[model samples]
Target: MQECSPPAQVAGRTPEKALLSPSRARYGEGMSRIDRPALGILLICAGVTAISVNDFQIKLLSGGYPLHQIVFIRSAIGLALTLVLLRFEGGFAALRTATPGLHLLRGLFVVAANMTFYAAVAVLPLAQATALFFVAPLFITLLSIPFLGERVGPVRLFAVVAGFAGVLLMQVPEAEGAGTVSPGVLLLPVAAAFLYASMQVLTRKLGAQASAAALAIYIQTTFLIVSALFFLVAGDGRFAEHTTNDSLRFLLRAWHWPTPEDWPLFLGIGAVAGVIGYCLSAAYRLANASIIAPFEYLGLPLAILWGWLVFGEWPSVLTWAGSALIVGAGLVVFFREGARPRPNRAARR
Candidate 1:
C-alpha cells in the first residue's frame, strides 16, 4: 500500500460541497423549539378538560355515593399518580424540604378547593358551577394587594367589578314560583370559588421553588386524609360494605350504586379524567396563569352541552345571558392584560 493522500475529487462533488454538507449546514441553523406561550395556553386548556371530566365522573357517582367518598378516591388516585411522577424525577429523597409547614398549608387549601368544587358539582349544573368557579381569577387579582404588595390598577379594579356583576347576574335569587335561578344551589359554587381562588393565589406565591410534582403529591395526600376523616365522622363510612344495591342505597340515602354492567362508564371516566389532569399540568407550566385562567369559562358552554347530551338538562335564558357576560368580561381581561406594557428593567434601576 502506498502512502495515502487527501482525495482530489470524490463522486462529482467539489471540495466546498463536501465540507458544507446538508447535515453541517443544518447544524449552524438551530432547531426551532415549541413556543412557550402557546404551550402555556394548551396546557391550561388541558387542565380545564381534565377537571371537567373529573366533575362529570363525580356527577355520575354522586347519585350513588357521598361527595366526600368520591373526593377521597380521586385524591388518592391523584396522590398515587403524583408520587409515581416524583419518584421518577428524583426518588423520595427529593421530597426532603425545609418548607414542610408551607407545603402542609398549601395542601389544606388544595383539599378545600377540590372538596368545595366537587360538592358544588353534586348540587348544581356543571355549567353553573364552572361559571361561578371562574371568579377565582378576580380573587387572585385582589389577593395580589395583600400577598404580593402589588397595587390594583383602575383597569384591573374595573375588571374585578365586572366579574362580580357577571357572577351576580348568573346567580340571582328566584322570586316566588318564578324559578328563574336557584341562588341557593349557586352558593355552593360561590363558596368553592373563594377557596379555589385562595388556592390559586397561594400557588402563585409559592412559585416554582418547590418541586411541582412533590407539591401536587402533598396536596392530593392531604385531600385524601381530610376527605376520609370527614366521611368517617359524617357516618357515611360504610360504603366499602356496600356489596349490594340495597346497601349502596342506604349509603347514598336516595340513589343506587352502579351495577356491574355500568363499570365501563366509571372506567371511561377514570381514563378520560386521568388524561385531562396530565395535560392540564403540562399546560399550566407553559402559560401565564392570569391569561389562561379566563378561558376556563369555555368550560361553561362545554359543560352545558355535556349536561344536555347526558342528563337532558337545559340552561335557562338568564343562565345563557349571565354566562355570556362572564365570558365576555373574561375576554376583556385577557386582551387588556396582553395590551398592557411589560415593565422595563431600566425604569426599575
Candidate 2:
C-alpha cells in the first residue's frame, strides 16, 4: 500500500494544482497517507448525494414532464457542460472515433441504462433502486474476468454472492408487503447495472485512444439526441396512446418548472452534479478501477437519507440490515484491491 507519486499528468501544471490541489498530486508519495483516499471517498460521497438529489428531483418532476423530456433536458444541459470542458482538450473533432461501431453500441447501452433505471425509479423507492443498482459492481467483477482478462479470486466471488444476497434481502420485505415483485420492475436495475458495467469496460478500452472527457461528451450527446427523439415520438403517439406507462409522463405530470423561487435547488443540482461528474472523471484518471469502484456504495446511505427526508420513504429495518451487508461486501472488495499492487505508472493512465 505504498503511495506512489502523481504521474506527469500533474507535473509543473498550475491549473492541475488548482483543480486537484497540490495535496492531491502528492497522493503518490504516501506522505499524506490518509488524504488521497479520504478525498476520493469524500468525492464519491458527494457525487452520490448529488446524484440522489438529481434522482429525487427527477422523480418529483416526472409527475409533470415526460421521462424522455426530463432526460432530454438534463442530458442537454450535461452535454453542454461537457462540451465546454472539452473545448480546451479538443472540440467535437476530439470526440470523433475510429470505432464507430463501439460508439453506436455504447450510446445504445447508455440510453437503455438511463431509461431502464429511471423507469425503475418511477415505480420503486429510491433506496430500492439504488440498492439493486449495487449489482453493477458484481457485474463488473464478473465481466472483468472475460473482458479485462483479470483473474477473480474466491474472496471476490464471495463478495459478489453476498452482494446479491443483500439484493434478495431488500426485495423480500417489499414482496411480503406488496405481493410479488414483478420481474420486469425488479430486474430493470439489474439489467441497467449490467449495461453500465459493460459501459465501464468499454470506457477502459476507449480510454487509451480518446480522452475520458471526450468520451463522456460523446455519450451524453448521444443520449440527448436519442432522448429528444423518443420524447417527440411519445408526444406524437408513437407508443400506446401516449399512456402514463412511459417514464417521461411520470415526471412532466408531477411538478411544474422551478421558478425564480426554486432557482437555488435547480442551481444546486446543476453545480453539484457538474462537479461530481468532473471529480469522478478525475478520480478514475488518478487511480485504478478497483480502488474507486467500492466507494460507489456511499450513494446508498445518501439515497436512504434523501428518500426519508424529502419523500418520507423510510426503508424497512430488513432493508437497513441488507444495505449494511452490501456495503460491507463492497468495502471488503475495495480494501482487498487497495492492498494489492497497482499497475505500473505508464499503464495506469
Best by lDDT: 2
lDDT (tens digit, per residue) of candidate 1 on 232-291: 565444544554432233233422355786556556544543444444444444344445
Badly placed stretches (over 4 Å) of model 2 are: 1-43, 90-93, 173-181, 205-208, 237-273, 341-346
Residue range 25-70, candidate 2, lDDT tens digits: 2323112223345565565555555676777776665444556666
The top-ranked prediction according to TM-score is 2
Q: Per model, how many backbone clashes are there?
A: 4, 22
Q: lDDT (0-100) at residue 14 of candidate 1?
A: 17
